[model samples]
Target: MQDVRVIPPYPEANEDGIREGKSKSSKFSFNFNLKPKEVKAHLDKYVIKQDDAKKTLAIAICDHYNHVAECIKREREQGDSKSDSDEEYTKQNVLLIGPTGVGKTYLIKTLAKLIGVPFVKADATKFSETGYVGGNVEDIIRDLVTEAEGNVDVAKYGMVFIDEIDKIASAANLIGKDVSGRGVQTGLL
Candidate 1:
């Protein structure tokens, strides 16, 4: 391995500046393996005046790929897991936080399409807290599993977007109904 110091030439001790140099400890990076032109194509679909978020995520995806590629190369040299090498894929998930109609949902759907993954959308509000008194919270996962039934390939490597999640803010006394909001987040996790 080459010994090229990764530390800054002139260290600036600011809060924003990275104190320590990059290390191999953080090998866990998520990547979808999208090409440069394909990335540009996806970004182009969105409207103008909002290139910052798009560019940041795009670069982040590329950086993640680079990091994982480096690890893969080292693993090949050391003869590591064969399955990972054969199936070059990474489960990279992202969350969008913004107001409605700001294209947050559109971004997830567009990204899924760009990456050729099965995109699934769900409304968290429509789900009731009273699942017949005995029903559990795992129905969310069951619903997702059902959604991706026929498309196994894409389902294995796809996206699920939950909208209107702010509906059940308080499950303890939801509109005078004894529902559980915490249960939903727990089920989601």
Candidate 2:
């Protein structure tokens, strides 16, 4: 598909705003005549390892496009009457739990990188129960918003990794909660 530039009129013209023949707004738009597989092939040249994670992200992007395509088809069939996202099939929200340093963090981050989505990694230990002294739980979201960048507005639509969840149960005990060995089962559950 080709895009034609219909530049809006600017009352004022400066060297920085309009140089040679093109306006500054054209810089924000991108034009590419390339296949996705070709782009992936090029990215692979620089990104080493994590090929599976990269491919999974590629599939996810493809699925998003598939969903959009399906939406377009539905609009075509129905003409003016169309259903919103609430009426359509939704994607599943996933929770990933595993041992430490098992690529849980890396997998999410790699997926974000491959697909250009925002991502946040938070430790459950940061949040305390009831009267525990530390930063607020909402701060996590706030931090994520401040940390987000690029074409990826991940803070609005992204993934989160909650680490060290087991510690939440372990820390709940004040003194005698762990002496009976019941804490282990209480935690692993």
Output the worst ten-in-a-row residue range by lDDT, candidate 2.
Answer: 11-20
Taking the tens digit of each residue's C-alpha lDDT, what string does model 2 give over 68-119? Answer: 4455457567864346663765654344555665565776564444433346
Which parts of model 2 have CA positions greater than 4 angstroms off? 1-85, 129-132, 149-154, 166-189
- How many clashes does the backbone of model 2 have? 0
What would you estimate as the lDDT of candidate 1?
0.51
| TM per prediction | 0.53, 0.45
Per-residue lDDT value at 57 in model 2: 48
Residue 151 Cα positional deviation in candidate 2, in Å, after optimal superposition: 10
Alpha carbon deviation, residue 16, candidate 2 (Å): 26
Residue ranges of candidate 1 with Cα displaced over 4 Å: 1-32, 35-41, 59-93, 129-149, 169-180
Supply candidate 1's per-residue lDDT for 166.
76
What digit string (tens of lDDT, one per residue) describes model 1 on residues 70-138?
555566677763455446655345556667777767766666555433466877665555464543445
